[model samples]
Target chain A: MENKTEYKPFEVDQHLTAHGNYWAGKAGSRFFTSLRDKKKLLGSPCKACNKVFWPPRSVCTFCFGELKDMVEIGPLGTVETFTLVTYSEPIQPRTAPFIYAVIRLDGADTGMAHFLDEVEIGKVHIGMRVQPVFAKDRKGNILDIQYFKPL
Target chain B: MATKDKEWISIPMTVDVPYRFAAGGYMTKCLTELRDNGKIFAVECPKCKRVQLPPRVVCAECHVKNEKWVELPHEGTLMNFTIMYLPLTDPTTGKPHEPPFVYGSVRLDGATSVLDHMVEVEPDMDKVWVGMRCRLVLRPKEERIGDLSDIRYIEPLPGQKKPQTKSR
Candidate 1:
């Protein structure tokens, strides 16, 4: 029955525009504001399991305990893993051939994804020491820290 | 418990997501024919014989395969219309189509479905009306990109005056 049926192919291209507003709730506001005002990185340490979250959460994933203790994590961190992006898109913060890395900051148990700058892509490797390069003009946002560079 | 005033802060952000969709077998056939040959094709249901535009594989109502193909004429009658005052987004380009434009659903000659598109007439009651005779105005062949936007806009057939309005 499938062999008897004939098929013809066609293509339709559609583009859509979407607009939305997002609020970085209670815990996230604290994490981002500290980065903006003091150029400090903060993490929420779970009292039960003792795991530190880089992008701090209000509740622990394992114990569901309220996480109130905020600790300063890293001015410097080690690159856990990274990739070099050669393609461009409308939403990308930087131009093509930029290095994006997962960095495990000093005194923190978790890693966060951010851009790595001031070094060749061929030179970036796991365990490379990197430090945050804070932007001159600060906003309570992730981009407040311009990028991490080899230290 | 001691009560303490807590300061809460909020931040603003924007996210843009892009996507691509594949027009499957039936629609591909209909759109290509419209693009290359300047002919509109529809699929007719095997059970109910209702011809659907942007041809589908199965009849939505009858649940039977739509195998027969029908070519519809370029001219159609304006079934309903609205003068948009809001800047509606054109999804394909993530841009807003300029406001205060005439948009209408047209039921083409010899087709059961209505094609909704921009109606290129003044946004006035005396100028545009229901049952207006309109024809598809396609983009030039060189500019045709095998998409719905290829049909530039629908315009009132030349020399046709608005129908006489009747009192309710």
Candidate 2:
């Protein structure tokens, strides 16, 4: 059907660059600092509930306790859940068809989400044993653990 | 075990948010006309007879359908102006327009509305003022794209000088 116009539609391309400064809180400060300096994975533990959350959070979800002390978590873990992203996005860390998985690290009570690699997309599944590959130039963020690979 | 010294860090990050816009029927006709023929078009309201540029489908004042098209002259009068001191990013191109530049609203000859555009003149007050005559400077025909960027900037018509201060 003719929309009946003298000219074709025009598409305009544009982008916005957003600048932000974020502070790592009391627990997160120590958590990220551990990753950048010592190449260590730290977990925040809630003593009342005995739950250690990896990708350390400031507060415990269930018991609502203040998680002050941090414990070193795993460089190795198991994939609890995962999905392969077939489409590309501007904000993704890698190219398309990469895997993002929820990993339950050894000695930690909860699952943390991160990128998974070094294995065939078809072969990856739940309970797959994996180990982290740390980035050489760590920026004191979760990206410090670049990705996880099959053990 | 007692924790060691506090090691807190604040991180600075830059993120890019991409965007795309579609120029609908009214603007599509106006922009394409500029790119292809170097002609400008404005929609005239049947009720109020207001010729608005960047042609709109509906009249802003009369609430009537804008059906009549009027051609606008590239020449116009500067209604108002400002000398910018901060480097504001041009959202269309994602680049800064560079500080201490001049831009203003120009009401083209025969058009009722004014279009805000970059004025290609020295930023000093002595070099520019309100009510100055200006003409649009567009990119070459071969380089013209069907967007507002097709018009490079506004150039003030020569021979006019800023008036001396009033004695009042």
Candidate 3:
């Protein structure tokens, strides 16, 4: 194929940088705090249907009721889907080809999303069992569980 | 009357902005290395046989992993190019890319695909065209960051003959 240099139009000059802070809301705080205790947590039940929500939503999806309190969940689950990631410069750790996945944790009705590590990409599957690997020192944070690995 | 006073009122100001990055995978490492070495790299998919420029971790078409790495030749033929007269914000650095500038996709000599970059060209509105040859200008290592800026811009390769366009 021949190389063609045709003048096309584009907006070539605008600029910006990392310009804000992330503030966790109430449900987010509680969700992470419970993870520090080594307890898998999900948002409150619907008084009507007894369903659990994760990422601890403010309201129930099934019954449409307000959610309150939190419930502890098990650590194991099956992999639903995943993709590989590569973190680079200015990206601390500089890790490339890192895998992240959506896991359907055991005992919890809904799945949680997090980084997947310590396994072969080909070995992983939709039904592969996996568990969260918490950091040695826990402070009740989502990062407390560094990532999930095949069990 | 008010113009004289307004001239003295001019002062420098800074503005803050928010941005999100979606970068991930081996492409990140490849770009980092390119900035570090003053070179560019690409990957070839064994399955579909399409050499992907700006190497990706997996083949989008083949659904297979790409593990081999090959260093690319710095020179290339300018594929599709453009000269933008309007200003736009730089996504990575959050600054404005200079106006009256050119950008294009260049097919590196060794790689199978073309990459987009700042193409060197005359600012005159009259004399730009297709099938131009360009060369890469790289930044020094110490000053380099693992970003596209590592290679300053693509300029006309030395001693290359200009193409004659057929008049329609």
| Tens-digit lDDT track of model 1 for B4-59 | 56434565556555456678877777777767877788888878888898788888
TM-score of chain B of each: 0.89, 0.88, 0.78
Best by DockQ: 2
Tens-place lDDT per residue, model 2, B1-168, is: 435677667788899887888988878888888999998899888998988988988987888888888889999999999999999888767689998899899999999999898999999999899989999999998999887778999999999999888868
lDDT of 3 by residue, A67-103 (tens): 7667766577788888777655444332677787888
Candidate 1 accuracy as TM-score: 0.72
The prediction achieving the highest lDDT against the true structure is 2
Candidate 2 Cα misplacement greater than 4 A, ranges: A1-5, A15-22, A47-50, A61-66, A84-90, A96-98, A117-125, A128-130, A133-137, A149-151, B1-7, B10-20, B94-99, B166-168
In the predicted model 2, the residue pairs found to clash are none
State in Å the error of residue B55, model 1.
1.7
Per-residue lDDT of model 2, residues A1-151, tens digit only: 1234457778777788789989887878888888899998889888888788877888899988877788998878999999999999877768898899999999899998899988988899999999999999998888889899999
Global lDDT scores for all candidate models: 0.85, 0.88, 0.69
Q: Write down the TM-score for model 2.
A: 0.79
DockQ of 3: 0.05
- Per-candidate TM-score, first chain only? 0.88, 0.85, 0.73
Which lDDT value does model 3 have at B137? 85
